[model samples]
Target: MRRPVTRRVLAALAATATGAAICVAVTTPQASAAVGSATGFATRNGGTTGGAGGQTVRATTGTQIHAALCNRASSSTPIIIQVEGTINHGNTTRVSGSSCNTAADVIELKQISNVTILGVGNGALFDQIGIHIREASNIIIQNVTVRNVKKSGSPISNGGDAIGMEANVRNVWVDHVTLEASGGESEGFDGLFDMKNNTQYVTLSYSILRNSGRGGLIGSSESDLSNDFVTFHHNLYENLDSRVPLLRGGTAHIYNNHYVNIRESGINSRAGGRAKVDNNYFRNSKDVLGTFYTNQAGYWQVSGNTFDNVTWSSRSSDNNPAGPNPTSNTSISIPYPYSLDAASCVPNIVSQTAGANKGIRTSNGSCATQNPTSGPTPGPTGNPTPTPSQPSGTNLSIGAGSDGSSKASGTSYGDVRDGNMSTAWSPSGATGQISIKWDTATRVSRINIREASGSVGNVRAWRVLNHDTGAVLATGSSAGVITFTATSLRKITFEITSSSGTPRVAEFETYAS
Candidate 1:
């Protein structure tokens, strides 16, 4: 059970401060790199190195943080702000400037880019305040505590989210922070960490989210499906009711995290979303993984996870819990590099490393050895098996079967092999997968991928995978003639990893000649 927060102290502080501004002048410092490199999906999409190679400033109030953004020469100018002390609505105000768009009553990082807010000195606490990031990119928020935020209380901010990102947000790395609420949505608290509205390439690592009704979510609803490519690693989630993320639609890699006392549910992937959940420990939780509250299902690829004293709910149309003996419903191929600490060690590693003011310690992602620093090694784990050679022949896919990770609303997975150049298949997002399958093992080494007439050149990068063995048969940029060592398999997947637009494949022709 969580204790109620004492708001009287904070209310008195808010009352003492008048509407007058607290002037704190700051000078631009020498250029420097970010305090730490981003990991996971945040390392993708040109990487998130917030406030590097520009300037550094110190702030004691939320207003000063906004002033730093407003004072930048340009909205994209890189700047780091080290914050100390408490930030509430009273000390936060709207700052007008050409380079920034800010608002009162919340810590707003809106319509800006390349900024980092780091807590220092005695540590920064956003008491009853929320940090909102919207229409922003290349941002980092670290080593702070945000608590007791509410959407329906007398003093409200950020709709009760401790840290919320939305509206085309990109490349955000939120690490080493603590986000918590005293109670559930009925008590006026919402999600602790949330992203929506086309947000992409974000990572939340080495953090703690506890005692909240909702832990977080990727997309806002079943219809709001534009968000994708997020990662959650080495974090602690405890005493939460549900939505220990409610993933609506996206690719989320949740690894090396510790989940405890999840009262209702956890990792609720629904509405065609896919989650690669690996190397995690779930203890004393109920329905920790599954598609619940909806008939529309989601998917997950599970590996190396430990469940202790966890309970499962009975199967129903509105409650499908992946428990008792959870297994993979879909195979998710991760495009980034990562290392996994053994599942047995996740609880210990996360306890020592997750959250703010803990020396920013992290598990080296190796169970045998624990290092003080963070960052994953190069090369991806859980790679597919090696591809073997095959014999030359004609088009093997002409009469073969087809499937995919996802398909666009108007398209079908079978359309990739219908041999009709006009009818095509597209992913639900800008990037996803399409595959061809057979009842028996088949051999092939070549594939001619014909793009839809209007969608030609939409694919930027791709990989040919042996879906049967999860092996990387071939990788290249653009779709055309793809060749590799012939491999015999029941299924082969053509995965579009990067694209400028939603890719459409008219034909996925397979050959062996």
Candidate 2:
């Protein structure tokens, strides 16, 4: 929603050009002149030039200044555009000229690649993005400050993107850039760049983005699932109203970044096919990170990430009943929120299960019930068998049996652990045999199951019930241990039942391959 500054208005300003002429002229210094011809621009303190195409034209406005550079010859030859002083436009101020037409904007990158638009030592500021890229690639926009971009049309429109990159650009590098937005109703859109569609191999690093809407840094997919391969690292994000950093889709690597004072989530990965996230820091945020609602089974490796004062939540649309669970396994090793100091720093491991339960456990107790006969039962065609009901606080132990020999029980389907615990089948009311179907072929060897209870009738019998064929695997009574081996299916469930009187089981622990 950025307004275009027309060439006709610049032509009018050129006609009234007066004062010191701050023309963008390239000059080689004596030292560098001997080494090579250095490229740059020379301009007066505060003045304007006219004309739109010539290398030496004057215009009274920043828009005109930008137009002059756009009209330069040789797209491969880098042009040096300089800002004389500050150009004020209402509440907005710019280092160079502002405004662009569709034709004029496209002309800026007609055939350019290695272009470097350096800012003045004091840097430049604009109400909107300083430069917007379209159908351009291998570009580097560095050492610049872009601030206070106006929202597009309204709150709903796509506006205030600091640098908008569209139309299949590639191999771009944005470094050492600073973007700040005034925190109000006018939220900043994309910070360094807003990319979509077939844009690949881009890198955004060593930048500071603060107070942006939607995302501080974003890579999006507009329908066809753009194959974006972006890398974001060593950046600092502060006061982002929404998700500070995000990977919308494709392959992305996010690492070593710091997020502070975030409102919603620190980092969000939505609809992305595959991503690798590691070694990042999230401080004082509502939820530290999230991955949700991907059409395909998305794969994410979250490792060695640190979170202080962070909250976590998860919800998914996949009708698996077990919920969309993310695995940290052994690679996630960040400290919990309650253990960190005000400014503590901790290392993030790649495969540690530190925050695995942050999104899964809503409340502390189990929601299991025992129905003797009457209850809403599942349809015969797709329903699992009925499991037994047990009370709470049941204690079951596992060790060498009365004969001082180990007994084997339970079955493993695919790679998943099902029906290994005494209470697993009780909550689901699955009676009879318990079967497992693995999504893929898997090899599992060892298994362990334990039930904990206080009194005699408080202990119930437990067994593995396969929902597929309605068959029970290993059955046991009272509080005891069971061990066995079996292959696991991709998806399966466990079944439990009362052996004698209804027993109270406090915990059901299972260890399996």
Candidate 3:
């Protein structure tokens, strides 16, 4: 029924609450990289150069996409198939002379290599369809959304994930895309992205993953440790249960991501996975980064990470938090050169660049353009002034704040507006007060706070007070996106009168508009 890659992916997470389900079925570009390069394998591969020295064909239907792959001249011919509309698998056709029939399930690229699947126009979508890449190499997938691919019990038709890879898969770059399902197994969905069995040199950039029980995972077992040299950056992971993603044995470079409302956990590095966790904003999540709940202890070099209201577990038999409270790790070198966007800029950058339909957003470091291979991107729309998405005012409270009654190293009060959300100032208690005062009188209108994880999060009763005058400039229980009149002021403080529980305010941001 289902292929080797699909079955292997499903087998990895078919039991966990947020585990991946069987795919119904599905599935990159080519880089013109030399056999080996310093750019790292994943960054060096993708679509712009996929069809080079070959054909650049445009396909508007599922059958056309299948035809482009099936009719290719060997695995190295280099074909870039441009997809321009929603390709629904329900109406797919059979691939001639191959058991890889699409009418039943997925668009299989069993042995295809040197191909780039580029989505074009308003945006291309693979709806209720999946793409499988196995025994393939040198691929790129960009500017597309893969969603609602249902799972099937019929082994052949259960295409599996939004994207699945295994067995000698290599050198792929997936950028500016959205992959999701309504829920986990019960909803017939699987991993948004997955890799197994010697798969290596992959980069997932500027992508949006949301509303799923499981995000993604690397190896299938503690013994399957060959997966390595992967990079995940500037991706937005929101409303997930866990594994944004669960690393195992690979050497992964993770940075500048906005992880929001990870209902269960985030970045569960295990099985000796060496992760360089740097400059990420982890809000409303538990154990954001560390050797997580597993008997096999993974190592991490975590720095410049803003951990808001995140929880830490004890060093139990199978659950290790890996901290000063757990264990320390040495920093590893990332194969490619990358610029660290301040953790504070994570939300702004990820929200704007991630997911499909984003018009030609700037690439990350040396990474290439992720826009579709179609017409030029449309210009800005109606609004022109300062907006919430793009705050136009100065954060006067920068480097100015205290934990009021309690403070700790790396969690000091001054971390609030240091232009890094990865580091926060958590006070002593839920009912405590953390305030900001200016030596000189300053005017302000907007304030935003990113809460910590777990039940203690969700500030319910809070008040912003003028410290110098003891006058209330603005007061409310709301923590995120709080705005008031631009008033001539000297000081501001947030008092937690009541909350959903303890208020772990990770970021206390103020802006004048």
Candidate 4:
């Protein structure tokens, strides 16, 4: 359920800041109190009064308030900047572009320490980025919603990330905040929150990210200066569907989050860093799991998670572990009649020799054990259809082109690359009365179909064409494009039979759709 940010909460925030100002004015010594509350500022509604702690300057615009606050001093005893009303910047106010220029309206904490910038609930809309902390320490940005922040100005380029904490900044906490629609132009949104370059001890929790091109949180280091000890817990990431990579980092804890309707992998671990991904629910993802680089010294523990109606391979290998029994505690549960590649599930631990070795003890369970009140049995061609099981190390080649080029028969329909191209399956024919074969390649989730001939009748059913065995693993009458989970990577063949009582054979395509 979505939480509402009410006006009453905003009123309370204003009241709290006011109360703090009164207490600081009365308790501190005359000299110290003067330094704290020196400036006598007026409210946004235009009332002038000398507040105890610094100037209580209220600005209607977030940009105006941020500029005023950034102009403060670097004293050890910093002034508190209390904000009232929504500060809309960048695209939040439907501005010209996606992001606010960092140079124009950025709040830089230069050589400043022991400061708090408090905002009313939805009081400040850090449009481009809520706050940018660089070369400073002991900073806190709480109860803020940073939306529509772009890293770069170019619309074509993938820049303008929402929040950036660069350089030697330490002891930073971004809590009770929301980062959404930040990253990617072709996808939903485009931007990234980069916490890099020796930036350590950062905690981002209780946030919501939706319709973003990238994942909710990204912690990485371009330099080798060890960006570590970041925790991402109790956040929601949904509808982050884009081609760009999401969640790339090293040495972090990602737990207790809800991920829904992501076009790409739900959570990704790239680089050589170690991460603990556990206690999360991933539902309706284009691809569930992926690893750009694994098998390093650090540990990647994926345990105690639930997956429902996920697509493609749940996990992939970028780099496998080198030691004996390095990976551990990973499990998955799917509906009945759903099968996964056994080889992909095996831990990538290296033995003494240079061969592939298993490292972790993984388990699988059925959803029926938990959901007793589940619906009726699925049909044969439904999500839980049976798949053919094959041994490991099988060679399967999938090709998509306009020409009718059969890899198995060595026949070319025409210029295989030209014409209205569609993805085609090789070695067409059904082995038994089934729709798919499994256990050949590492993974098979979905297939993209291409219609070469304008007539679309050339393709009959979305069948799993096996090249090595020269048989069809599975056959489904559903036309256009079809996606199913298979155990292995076997060469898939599409049966291009005449659908309109004519010899209709055009270019058909298939991929992990």
Candidate with top lDDT is 1
What is the C-alpha lDDT profile of model 3 across 82-133, one tens digit per residue? 6677877554555442222233367666666767776766568888787777
Kindly provide the TM-score of model 2 when superposed on the true structure, using C-alpha atoms: 0.48
As for TM-score, the candidate ahead, 2 or 4, is 2
TM-score of each: 0.68, 0.48, 0.64, 0.45
**Candidate 4 has what TM-score?**
0.45
Runs in model 4 with CA error above 4 Å? 1-59, 67-76, 88-102, 128-130, 152-159, 187-189, 216-225, 242-249, 286-288, 293-298, 312-513
lDDT, residue 214, model 4: 67
What is the alpha-carbon lDDT of model 4 when measured against the actual structure?
0.40
Q: Which residue segments of model 3 deviate by more than 4 Å?
A: 1-41, 44-49, 97-104, 153-159, 323-328, 363-513
lDDT of 1 by residue, 319-395 (tens): 88998889999998888899999888676566556776654556676753233343211111222211112324666
Return the lDDT, model 3, position 290.
Answer: 66
RMSD of each: 21.2, 26.0, 12.9, 20.1
> Cα lDDT for residue 98, model 4?
18
Q: Write the per-residue lDDT of candidate 2 for residues 1-513, one digit (tens) a residue.
A: 423323321222211123333333443211110101111010111111111112223232354444544444434333334332333343121222222222322113323443444334333444343356666555554445666655543322124566666666655655445666666344434454566655666666545676665454345542546756666655556677664555566665666566666775555555544456666666666655555334433345676666655655555563111112334422322211111111112111100001110110011112221221211111112212222232222121222111101111332221122223333322222222233343454333222332322122222345654434445545443232333445453323334454322222333333333
TM-score of 1: 0.68
Count the clashes in each prediction. 1, 65, 31, 47
Q: With candidate 1 superimposed using the best TM-score fit, by how many Å does residue 269's alpha carbon deviate from the native?
A: 0.6
